[model samples]
Target: MAAMKKKSVKKKSVNKKTASKSPCKQKLSVSISHDHKLGHDPLAWLSGEEIQSLSKINDTVDPMTFKETKIENEKIHVPGIEAEKNIDQPVALEEMTKDIDDVKASETGSLPGDEDKTQRTNEDDDMLILPEIFGIAQAEDMHGELSSLLAVSGDIEIDASTIETLDASALQLLIAFIKECKSSGRNVIWKKSSAKIDSAASLLNIGTLLEL
Candidate 1:
């Protein structure tokens, strides 16, 4: 009976020790829920006023146009020029258009007052200038004038500035005279012409042929 009692006591002690060890070796767990307070809000790093100020600041971007991209007084290099630079934008459209028109007029020989200046009589240049009214009314006088001009050893110059009209006969006579001058190796300059000459030549469709 004593030995059975001692065995029972030993078993009870072992059971108590096992119960203590089970409580000590229990697993630890952490849980979070919507009701849980995190002490401070995560957005507390930015103040309420700071967040509002940032939202008020406009961060939206705007699109750009071609004219806006070009800087004022910017220059562009042109080819085949003497390192000349042209402005990127035209200062005045009227001025630019006027300059372009002037260039075109010069190329087409149509600039205002250019004909008078170009065909002006050079009295000091020793060129043989014809009489002003080379009219068919005095066709014999014109013939005599031509004979005298051909008698000279130099080139001939015709001053047609005072002529107001040109008849068919006069036109034919002028053509024959020019042809004869060319055949004789004489340089004939039809200098100092008026608008009347050009008008008459154009009416006959012989402006280019007569070099009016």
Candidate 2:
């Protein structure tokens, strides 16, 4: 009977120790109620004055509207779009030629009265004034004038006082002109003579031939 009582006590103590070693889980009661709100206000922390200030900002600040700028009769080059070419635009050819002519006239240092003087020289065929520089370049033009003078029935008066340079070709042209005048029954009269003319003619041993 004592051994049975001791076994019962040992079993009670073992059960107590096992219960103490095991984990104890408490029951969690979660109850869902329809009285609870679904969505909470995100701006619930903002006061009435702050909310009114935000409303005023929303009313005053306008939403940006992008406007397409229309350009009339102008070419807008876009990156991907091919530009239309107007190939028929007339070139200012006459104006370009006029500009080139003006440039040439300016470079040559021609005066306005030069044309009138040349016209008079051609019309009158009486007096021929030699330029300050008489070169081979001017020989052809001088030949033309001399030929014209030869055609006219008048005594030709030559002014050589302004001749600063006299080329051999020019002296030759003058000699030919004097000879032609003599042959054409036209008198060759000297309106003015210069030492330059005389020296050039003498250097060529043709002073008597030029009647200088």
lDDT of each: 0.48, 0.56
- Estimate, for each residue in 1-212, the C-alpha lDDT of model 1 and write its tens digit: 01111111111112345545894543332222113223123353345332222223222111221123222344655666736775455455554455534553443342231222222122322243434555677566566445444544446677787776557767777777777767777677777877877888878897755655
Tell me how candidate 2 scores on lDDT.
Answer: 0.56
Best by TM-score: 2
**What is the lDDT, from 0 to 100, of the residue 11 in candidate 2?**
12
The deviation in Å at residue 91 for candidate 1 is: 81
Q: Return the TM-score for each candidate structure.
A: 0.37, 0.43
**lDDT value, candidate 1, whole model:** 0.48
Best by lDDT: 2
Per-residue lDDT tens digits for candidate 2, residues 40-91, read 2235335423222323321221112212222234344544563563334444
